[model samples]
Target: MTPLDQKINTHFPGLVVRKDLVRTVKGNAIVPSYVLEYLLGQYCATSDEATIQTGIETVKEILRKHYVHRNEAGLVRSNIKEKGRYKVIDKISVALNEKADVYEAEFSNLGIKRVLVDSGTVKTH
Candidate 1:
């Protein structure tokens, strides 16, 4: 461990989490390391193995309940289509069609394409 790591652990043993905890909890979430680490810090930032395990399960449960998988994005979109709104976690990209004078959005996860959008929208947000 680095000196800072050692120092952090020595001062706050339960506040620093193992690096692998992020990987263990991130199955198909496709999120950034900081985001996963933040989540782990919330529940599993401990050296105790048992507590870490419990925290892992807790994080997984939270992700399962909230995170959206790319494969299942269709369901979410369909829900929104039928019900007018739905929640989903997805990587979306948008581009400007200068020739067509419109904006196009593609939801890579949901496999949706050619979604017309406002030109004022930010790209790849």
Candidate 2:
């Protein structure tokens, strides 16, 4: 384990992420760092220290590559098309309006809503 992992495991056994660290961080809009880190940990955690480190590096690289900046949505869209599949990290939530027959998708940063997404995606998730 990395020192950070070891420290976390020692102090907060069975807890996946250090959620408390999120609030202390200051920024314009804080979307819990623990959420991103926790996702990274899901892909990286291993009994083998070297593999874990490599996995951590790989996940961070993916985040750096795919996480969009304002002008980079086109790049991300191209990547998704090229890769045929991609995991997009966003504040995605489902909501029902007065017309309860339909489900709405809310993409936080992209500011998109009620786009036609395949029902299979929801079922799989």
Candidate 3:
């Protein structure tokens, strides 16, 4: 790591990610760049090469478990129903359903739609 990188890591630990590492962890997933960066920031935000490598593996495991793909939407939906609640990483859009008088969320990549959302979450996002 360079002096500047070391300084940045020292000043802002757990908030920065190396650009190259983002590509390493991304691995053909059709997710946003910010998503990878956010995951890397949480796990690999450090100048230590060893820790970064381990963090990359951890992040990969997390993506494997939580990230939803379009092809696997049905399985994920089944899992959610079976488990009652499940957390997933996917693109979501929320809009007010005027006819139903409720806020509905659509998970774009997951191919799930019309899931009811609370007003607080709708307004916050």
Best by lDDT: 3
TM-score of 2: 0.54
> Which residue pairs does candidate 1 place in steric collision?
none
lDDT values for all models: 0.72, 0.57, 0.89
Off by over 4 Å in 1: 1-18, 27-59, 123-125
Taking all chains together, each candidate's TM-score versus the true structure is: 0.56, 0.54, 0.92
Q: Write the per-residue lDDT of candidate 1 for residues 10-125, one digit (tens) a residue.
A: 79855676777777777666766775676688787655678778988887776665556677676777787998876554556888888998888887667888889876566424
Question: Lowest-lDDT window of 10 residues in candidate 1?
Answer: 116-125
Across 10-82, the per-residue lDDT of candidate 3 in tens digits comes to 9998998889988887778776889899999999998778988999999889889999988999999999999
Q: Which candidate is the best by TM-score?
A: 3
TM-score of 3: 0.92
